[model samples]
Target: MTAVGAAAEIDTYMLAMPSPDSPVVLPQWISRGNTHPNSRYQDPIWSMAPLIDNPGTGLVKLHWKNCPGPLLDQVKLAAWTMINGQLRPTYLQTRGVQARSRSGGTDMLATCHEWMRLARWLHERQITSLAACAETEWRAYANERLSQVSRDTAAIICVRLANLWAFDQLSARPSGIARPPWEAEGVDDFLPAVGTAGGGENATEPLDPRVLGPLLIWAIRFIDDFADDILAAWAERRRMVAVAAAAKAAPAGWAALEEWLLPMARAGHPLPANSGKSEIQVATTYIAALTGSNRGQVSRFVKQYGLAEIAAERPGPCPLRVPVTGRINGEPWREHVDFNEAAELMKHLGTAATIILLYLTGMRPQEVQGLRSGCCPDPAPTADGTDGRRLIHSHHYKNVTDDDGNHISAGEVRQVPWVAITPVVHAIRVLERMVPEGELLLSTAHHEFHSRHGHAGALKKHTLTLRIESFVNWVNREAGVQGLSDQTIPEDPQGAIGLGRFRRSLAWHIARRPGGLIALAIQYGHMRTVLDARTSSSYGARGRGGIHAILDVETALAAADTAARLRDRVAAGENVSGPAARRALTAAAHTPRFEGRIVPRTFARKASTFLARDGIVLYDNPDAFLICAFKHDNALCEPEPGATAPRQYDCRPGCGNTVRTDTHAHQLRERADELDQFAAHAPGPVSKRLHANASRLRETADTHDATAHSAEALT
Candidate 1:
């Protein structure tokens, strides 16, 4: 055919009607709420906004504008094959295929981009048509992509390319890349599988301990102490906004403005100032809040009364008299929280609450973001009449499969709700106050619900991540004011904090901190043993799958780290004293170093088996100033029948499983001295209790000094 004739034929083919048997009719909207389809089959851009439910999925339009004009028809046709598979399954029979699951709007956008890449490469070489591209050239393109990206990405690229041949019958202009590469085998033959685990492994790096400690400390401070002030500020701001908005229609006169200013005058307070310019100017927004006046009324009142001069004479911060209840280092963290400062502080409060929920509950960021108001209702009393644990009710999209093992696009509500720790419950309560009932917990529309975009879904993951870092920066900047210079969160060596890292970090800490440090327990506001038991019970749940695997891996890895530390202490000529000291030495000599390396699911299984081996299970108990060489039979801490691990939290004074090194003895003595210092300044009864605890710690250290023997001699 002539070039002009071929071009005319291609344009005719591009505008061809959808299959007669297709589910959707012509010029129909593909997505929900899309009354009008943005494009016909031949349009360069396909709007996918209506096809997607969540804006966070990204890229609501597919731009075929970048493809060479000649190849555009072919690329659009290939996309239709996939789109037909997703949206019109009956049409696929024309291509000699059964109903096949295909990409949704987001994935379709990606697939379209993949096709454009091939088109760009072909256009670069001055190849105008798909049919003109040979099999060799196709293989070269696929191979080039495979080398540049991950196996998973390579697989996606190859599959999209293969589909051109696989569904050639559906297209008018078939490609000369006629057959699927690798003959009898497929892309899997050459490319390795992406992930090794059937049950997913957590690859997200946990926050460094230096970062986790102070970050959590500040998060708790915000929730526990700062919440009242922040929430109050928010309520006050809302009232002021409502009043001002109403006042826009019904303006306040000078008489009413004078009445509003009477209280400030009686209290001998200056007018609230605006720092918009370099000068101390009267703030119209504050005036509007005080007098139920609009901005125009406030402006007129300020000029008439010469309040700008008064504001300049008495310029400082807002004097709204909101109490500063939150304290740090036994002193008030702030003297006052002003309206403008409070407005800024509320966002940080939200971020801090997010940190508390994500870092403690082991909930994925999406799950936390998905939470709606009243998702975690107040706990009802148990059947046994004890206080029931709070549970978070939400839907999880990841790995939600149908009865036939096919993934569910819209996730179902989790059958088992996650047990909410106290901090998590508090965080939820605080979030509940931010948004209306039944709204998403972290909705971006919290402050601007009446805007054009109503209830703009949950804050995006990247936005939350930035807010978390901002919270850190804000804390660092204000640490000096709060007398927390030493407690400022250190920079994480792992780089920027991410939402995914919080769940993994929670697993790492819970698995490692088995000793039930008072700080850890208090941070959670629950018994450590109960937390361990309840959280583990939820392992293998339908919604939450990998957390159990993560916990097991972390436990084994923490043991390995503990053993390595023990070996170093022993090699440095430290003496060991305990009935299990020999077993500790043996385990230290044999246990492989983990060093926080990535472990596959198979390694997680092996880690479970390693933990089951009784007497050598070394648990580093930093809070107790000892190591626990756990053996179920010899344990002083009560163990359930057939249990493989000891309850480190319930350690008995004379437990045979206890091991004490010189380092542990030193820590014990140090703790005793610190207790003595505090006791010297404590009240009479409190001083007696502190002194007694110090005596006990000292006695334990003295006992270690007298009975400790060289680890080398024992071996």
Candidate 2:
């Protein structure tokens, strides 16, 4: 029937039939109770809460009440159809648009928003239905929308509108255009510039070094150093609460108060003062909780005995005596953690563990949230009698599909587990102590410290985001007290810290580091060979989220930056000499300028090609005081056969690829001078060895001065 004919009998045709007449039917793949479909399409709201297994996916309700009155039924019909995979053949026939399966909860919500936008636009123009709207009106809406949002975002809205044309026969209002939004042109025209058929570059910015370095330093410290104090304090808090609850049930009165105070008095231990304050103040409520007396009764007893004045004379009480093991600059980070702050500290500790996991494991935030207490078990032995590394098992939701390529709400277990490093394992162990085994490590239920307070479920992303910011603020606040002001994580120019940025930043660091695994080996205690052999390539390929693409972008950028720096140093009259110095100069001069440009996947492909040029690939090693013009054949650092990059961390002396500049000579002599100063303070035989090493360094400097020639003269 035509849309106009459908509108006449809309109530009879569109409204859901009685439950007995039309029993609830679900898609075969949708494991019955995983999603709830509203029987009546006339309902103001349709909740897909069960469909959202991951809280990180955000909201899942479609608010039909929010749409304009004229197109409400049309919007509902389109959304319902999309969720049920009921798209008409006409919509599937549209060029460059193909969606065969049911929409996921998150995608359904986005489609609803698109419908609302189109509905409001139509209503504002006094157009009641899609049948009356023409190509002219659609173009006007698209142009106005393109100005407000990005071309890609605008394209999504355009695609949604085009789908309506296919659903015209089903919708009572028939709100859609007959032709595509951009006539004779495809939706691909609005996408970001790319050279290949691959996806767009990752837009998530890696955390700036100024922010990431200190952030990680403090996060590791929280896991390694402060964890003991925090966990102990938490246990003490729980113990105290339990004792208080027992006393409340069986009121022991003033006799209990005397019994509690007498022991501390005999030991000459000060009363547990109000830990919330900076100065000592007898905690009457704390005393009452311990003694089972009212606060007034405890206050009366303290006044009669002059306990407040006596407490002033004695050192402040350390109720738990949880020693301050975490230090800064060779001293304890804090003298003591107070009982009042323990609950707050536990929350921050969870945030710290989260940061360590996200930054080190390269797991997405939701995957980290999905992690249970026993996610990482002890390392097992392989069949070959070798020790296997620890692995974390978790579920990934985004882009998770079944064998038929249809999106499924019930996320599957990752076939290849994430390899866990020491820091990640430490963080997991710390979290395991906080939450019960088999419970989510970051579950909101465990965060409250008290069983009655929080809702039981995965902690939401916005909540985690706030916790991250609070953790940063806590670090900065403690910096002054610890006298480590330089170690404070500065405010990111990219705005507040987030969990999403860690993966991108990790990929950047791993790909940009001198050796692919050198940074991981030092910071996380995992060898490069193990990660590469086990899961490195598959980790990037599994999701196809452009992690490998991101790595290539960073690698290319690093290479380009190194080449640019080399070119600048040569032009500034620095002398350069080595086996491949001339080749280095030539490549540096011709290297493409990529600074400040949006690096597309095409650039990534070109970057792979750029890195493949072996004999001339320049790897700057500041620690070694030289540049490596890496050649697979001549490399003494023992790169695997056919490897394009050099093992820069294992730079061997006398390698033909090593290039020494005027700066390297200066640094060598400077090092020799420092060693001479150390030699003067050493014992007899030790002093002689120091002097010999210093002399050797000076000789190397002299050799460089003799052989090095200016870049202008060499070319």
The candidate maximizing TM-score is 2
TM-score of 1: 0.81
Which candidate ranks first by lDDT, i.e. highest? 1
Candidate 1 lDDT over residue span 1-715, tens digit each: 7554565476432223344233321333243443434455655567654454442343267777888887876777777655543323333353333223444566667777878888889888888888777767766776676677656566566666666665554444444445646534646755645553222335667888788888888898898888988877667766776666677625345567778764564466877875764777776666676766777877777777666777788764664456768777677776767766766688898899999888787767767777889998887798999987677887776655455333344456877777777777888898888888998888887833323365346777777889898899999988866667877988888889888888778767766665433246544324334433434445224422446556667777888888999999988899999888998999889898875475654676787788788898788877788888988888877766655556666678999899999999999989999999999999999999999999999999999999999986888
Relative to the true structure, how large is the alpha-carbon lDDT of every model?
0.70, 0.69
lDDT of 2 by residue, 120-147 (tens): 8889989887666686877677767656
Residue pairs in candidate 2 whose N, alpha carbon or C atoms collide under 3 angstroms: 130-175
Pairs with steric clashes in candidate 1: 31-50, 31-51
